[model samples]
Target: MAQAYDPYTNVIHTMTKAMEIGHIDQSMFEILKNPQRETKVYLPIEMDDGSVRVFEGYRVQHSNIRGPFKGGIRYHQTCDLNEVKALATWMTLKCAVADIPYGGAKGGIQVDPGTLSERELRRLTRRYTFAIAPIIGADTDIPAPDVNTNPQTMAWVLDTYSQLKGHPCPGVVTGKPVELGGSRGRNSATGRGVVISAKLLLALEGKTLEGTTVAIQGMGNVGANAARIFYHRKAKVIAISDVSGGLYCEEGLDIDAISLYLNQGGKLLKDYGAPGVTHITNEEVLTCKCDVLVPAALENQITEANAGKLQCGCIVEAANGPTTEGADDVLEKRGITLIPDIFANSGGVIVSYFEWVQNIQELTWERDQVNEMLEKLMSKSFQELLNVTEECHCNFRMAAYIVALRKLVFAEKMKGIFP
Candidate 1:
């Protein structure tokens, strides 16, 4: 029987195995296994009700050998130090696999944003920013949007950081509104990266995106954007889900209408009535008949039990650690081609790098330029991943880890054990 998985331990185990398989040096592997810094902060915010509330917040900078620590700030009820550690470590590996000039870091506040009013959320964001302001900067650690956080959240971060400096410091955060020095395509970068990964994978098999059927779980920033792009690419996005519920149709749901509906607050698939569309549970959406399954939601979703039930042809993980180690083994035994989260959903950070570059250079790039650069990076990284997989005779997930570990371990070697 497979052991019950702890997400952080799972990440460390998989990474360690990849290093061994790739014949990376043990000393470097030892250094890569742990985070460089983990800071936990207690944020006290005065709510609009004139009540004081304390929230737990965390920032974990995993590595900085490649470049500045870069990742998103997640605001969810389940956010904790361990989860933040896993996310930060994934960010490091993701950036390295993409060959981008970034290390990995993640920040989170342990509160459900849904339960907070916009005013309360803003206060919380500012306070959290102030709490971590000293350690985060343009060239040190940059933050963007993640689950339950968006451009507005990043805007608040940029503003709070700048307010403390008494000068505009837009570089402190990416995924801000474009007017605030964010890149043009940073919002949809992760989804676009997913689409690009799909395209590259299909093309390698002499297939194209036009007729592919895709089901995506979690229609937030990443899944929704990926759905839109896949629809635009002529792929039939057969199913999609958010926190509320899921919707499915064999012929394809009208993505444009659904996108518009989702933009309105308090909307959900359970309430989204459309012709020939059927309401489905999140689990049903994952196992629905499709050519591609993109689990863009939370971790530990496709675990051992559910992994066997997945009916998709390919699994493109758009969420961090969406599949458990046991689930990975099952999927591998079944010969399913899965593009792991570290690589499949790396689009967000790649463009975050662009946004950071634009910020540091004090320049803005056109949408086309931003998108072209994103495409180049995604496709190039996909090719390199394939090359490594072929050489190592390993699965995509293992190959991705190996590729990332090589860069990280090599950097550690060059830096040579800091005294």
Candidate 2:
């Protein structure tokens, strides 16, 4: 049985397994299991239709033992405390794996952003910011972009928080417009990190990105950016999907043209047509013929139903919780290497950390410099994860969790429980 997909449960189950395998002290399990705090707010937005609607929102701070809390804010209709908690916990594990000086937290609002006009969306974002204002700051919890949110969203958050502070407070958020103190590489950091992780995994087997076949699900920021980068790196992206639909090309689609077509706005995969491209279902994108499959979409996309049917040699999770526990077992038994999301998608947070540093210091870094630093950090973390995987004699996901749990539990031990 696949077991029902509850992201929080899946995270805890994996964390507990990693803790047991890594020989971590069980006494600190409670702290890691429970979020430090969960904040829920009702955002009342005055709709453009001269009506008022209240949306539910949440911010889950999973841990701050390593440093201050940090994570992304997602505006999704399905956003809930459990999902946000899982995401926040992954943020903690991700930072620990990357050895970044930050903890984990996630914020989200339960609203279909597509239903709102731009003016309404802006108003909703600002109101959400105001509701969560007291607990967030430069030195406190910082939010970045996530699903259905972007640099413009962060700009709204930054502007709102700065208004409350009576000064420019760029550090209050990340992934803002570059003109508003956002890092140069922040936009594509997650996808870039995913590609970098894939390259590292391939290097261990004497493989390279050149000519590697890849199929990616969810052509959002993460998936689209990863597909473009992989295409530029000489890898053939055979399949790509978005909320609208999917497209496949046996001879490899023209990524540059597709990206350009979509970048113009008001376009979707169903609307994107060209030579050598064929329309396919999103599910088909997951099980397509390819050497690498990147699931950059929402959680539980790779459940047991399709886990056994995956045809890829490796899966670099560009989205959080893309693979479930049951799917992990399925892939492991199939001899497929699954690069966990925390390790694979740490780039955005890494750049987010850089953005925070730049904001606090009032300095900006060049694009090349940011990209170079991101690759270095990702490479170092990949090496550590490989070491842990070998030592634990387990899967990559468990090994990554082990590395993170060890660091988190050690920090908790050294600090001890508060009085």
User: Which digits, one per residue and each the tens of the lDDT, describe model 1 over residues 212-322?
Assistant: 999999999999999999999999999999888899999998899999998897888789998899999999999998999999999999988988888999999999999
| Candidate lDDT (C-alpha), each | 0.92, 0.93
Off by over 4 Å in 2: 1-3
Error of 2 at 261 (Å): 0.9
How big is the positional error of residue 374 in model 2, measured in Å on the Cα after superposition?
0.5
Error of 1 at 96 (Å): 0.4
TM-score of 1: 0.98
Give the C-alpha miss distance for residue 11 in model 2, angstroms: 0.2
